[model samples]
Target: MSLIHALVAQGSTIMAEHQAGKRDFSQATQTILSKIPPNNSKLTYVWEQYLFHYISEGGFTYLVMADDSAGRRMPFTFLGELQRKFIASPTASSSTTSLAPHALQSTFGPVISQLMYTYNTSPPTDDLARAQSELAQVKDIMVQNVEQILSRGERIELLVDKTDTMASQATAFRRGARTVRRQMWWKNKRVLALGIIVALVIVWIIMAQFCGAALRCGSN
Candidate 1:
């Protein structure tokens, strides 16, 4: 199966298991949260903030059940909301650009492309919205940083290399988008052909009845 198909199938199985109560929601949520890297302290903090806002806005209660020695659940909705607001605000837009100059230049290309892919799949109106918004913000920051580095007239070769990498990523994204569009077109064509076949059958029946009526009139 294709990667997309495999992902869909896995998602279906997970949903089914959850609905059946074989998988607990909290456990699943924690599993997802655990997969995020904690080493990138700044990014980790931003991500946690975004998650808090999303859950709060949806009026969902989330508890870090394992963290508290007293086994107490704390309301985290407000913190999440604040994080969401901060991320969405224009002031927080340039935060990612403030990384070490070398780090920014070295990782910006791949990171931007990955962020693009993430944005493409994100919903504009949900918790994913914050991610999508952040990706745009990050892209802008990267662009500005690249401009600044190029202005200093140093590391010209590195800039060229990064530009080439970005070009390849854009090409790949376009190819994937085109393939999806073609598949959708083919599906629509099949549906249209079925409708045309049904219409032709109806027309054939009508024509046959009309011919019979004319023959009867002529014979009379």
Candidate 2:
């Protein structure tokens, strides 16, 4: 099975176990965490790992840590990391062929709505203004598309055409966001490179002038 399918399956099992008051949540959490890259610096993993340990040990310190840090930071980072990993990994296009439109709509619809609402109500900060604006626009467009489909209230075949449409939109959003980040990175690199080159040139000119003065003095 694909990684996504495996994750979905594990998630469903974990939910079931949690509802039944079983002790499998820790195992399931560990399994999921193992799949993520070790280099991931997101604090969500620390939070989840702490929660898992807390549940297993029933220790007060684990609970305290969870309450103090994990509870506040994990949910958003966890969801964001899942989204990023899902987009970055390769998937069987055929598997996505079976996904229902309403399923897609139901899954992402509320998320997009929440983002839209958040962007509109939140004041722009100096660092996040561009990101906020871009996210707002993307959410607006996604909301319109999802609403249009939901309005039709009819089942559409998970055809290539529909899949392509959704995939293209997702790809475009990811590409555009990454493009902005890459441009900023390259801009900084260019500035640093130019500064280094200029400094080297100045040093060479100063050394040449010094050598010329030394030669003239020695001859005189």
Candidate 3:
């Protein structure tokens, strides 16, 4: 993979460049970019025996200059991988955050090298076939994950509702228990008062009987 140049850009500004000569590569990238329109996916052209391709994501554009023998699709695949790495980088919170050349290199140099090695260094004769197979597998996995999330969404909502209902019922039960306890306490107090009143009345009657007996004896 004779990839002579690559760069990360913020609009027209070259934030980072990779090649034998950083300044020369950055200049070449800018020169190539000056001749092309943004997001020109359907269009590709050769410049000085080097094929250039670009993918614009957000405010940042990723460009690659490769040897003519390098097929058209590899650059794009390279751009995709690079853009994903750039966006997922910790220093880059968003596409708007432009990383300087050294910062970009420090963050993604190893990844860039690995991708180029895997895809550019003596790649299979049928790179397109391999890319297509990998793409199909990715598509299938995404579809399954989305379906699972959709199904689980309903269950999550139901679980939330059940949790809320249980919380409300528990509060109501606590209130009811307090009320029952208070009522029982008052009822017991009333029973104790009634028993004391009855005992006092019985004592008064016994004293009156004794007094009458003494009066009768005095009269005799």
Candidate 4:
């Protein structure tokens, strides 16, 4: 599965969450959540073969863990969807000051489960499956190695001047393949259109020679 786990939290207090597999991510997720700055941000933390993507805004963080093969796009898109849904829910109106841990679990836990299931089962291969136009901004989001977040002196707020080289190369390859496919499709279309036109012209020429353009002739 692409999406393995997801959670909504206020600071280090998890309000609600969903895990899609048998693996326990509780300890790892809590550790990561504690490190997230209590401010507006979007980032991906690469650890081993998995990617932890999170969006922190309005004192709440929406996070999703996915296999790196899912790439940067899909997980962030899932977070975007999760954020939108959270904003619309009554849970958003609750006072963050008085909120208790896992308070929304009873109410919003099912929502997270459904969303996780949807995104995990349905890969975002088309525009329709995408969360929204917001996905267009995903490329601009910062991607950092997990070590960056764990290191004491390292800057956590580094600019997105570099992306994971392997992921970038893979993206480039996919784009190149798409461009070639589109060019070939158009080339074939133009060739077919030109052939049809040439065949029509040849038929007209034969008709003109046999029957004359302006002179209507009877079969003799």
Find the candidate with the highest lDDT and give its number. 4
TM-score list, all predictions = 0.24, 0.25, 0.48, 0.61
* Stretches of model 4 off by over 4 angstroms after superposition: 123-140, 147-220
The positional error of residue 25 in candidate 1, measured at the CA in angstroms, is 50
Ranking according to lDDT, highest score first: 4, 3, 2, 1
TM-score of the candidate numbered 2? 0.25
Order the candidate numbers by TM-score, best to worst: 4, 3, 2, 1
Per-residue lDDT for 1-220 in model 1, tens only?
0000000001111110111122223333333333322222111111111121112112111112112121111112222333344356443344333333223223232332333233234413464445445545542211111112133332121212344679999999999999999999999999999999999999999999999999999999
> RMSD (Cα, Å) of candidate 1?
22.2
Deviation of model 2 at 188, angstroms:
2.1
Candidate 1 is scored at a TM of 0.24
**Over the full model, what C-alpha lDDT does candidate 4 score relative to the true structure?**
0.80
lDDT of all the models against the reference?
A: 0.33, 0.35, 0.61, 0.80
Positional deviation of residue 170's Cα in model 4 after best superposition, in angstroms: 36
Clashes of each: 3, 0, 0, 0
Candidate 2, residue 177: lDDT: 97
lDDT of 2 by residue, 1-220 (tens): 0011112111112211111122223433434333323232222223212322111111101111222232322323223333443344343122243343233333433443343234234523442544445444542211011111122323221212345679999999999999999999999999999999999999999999999999999999
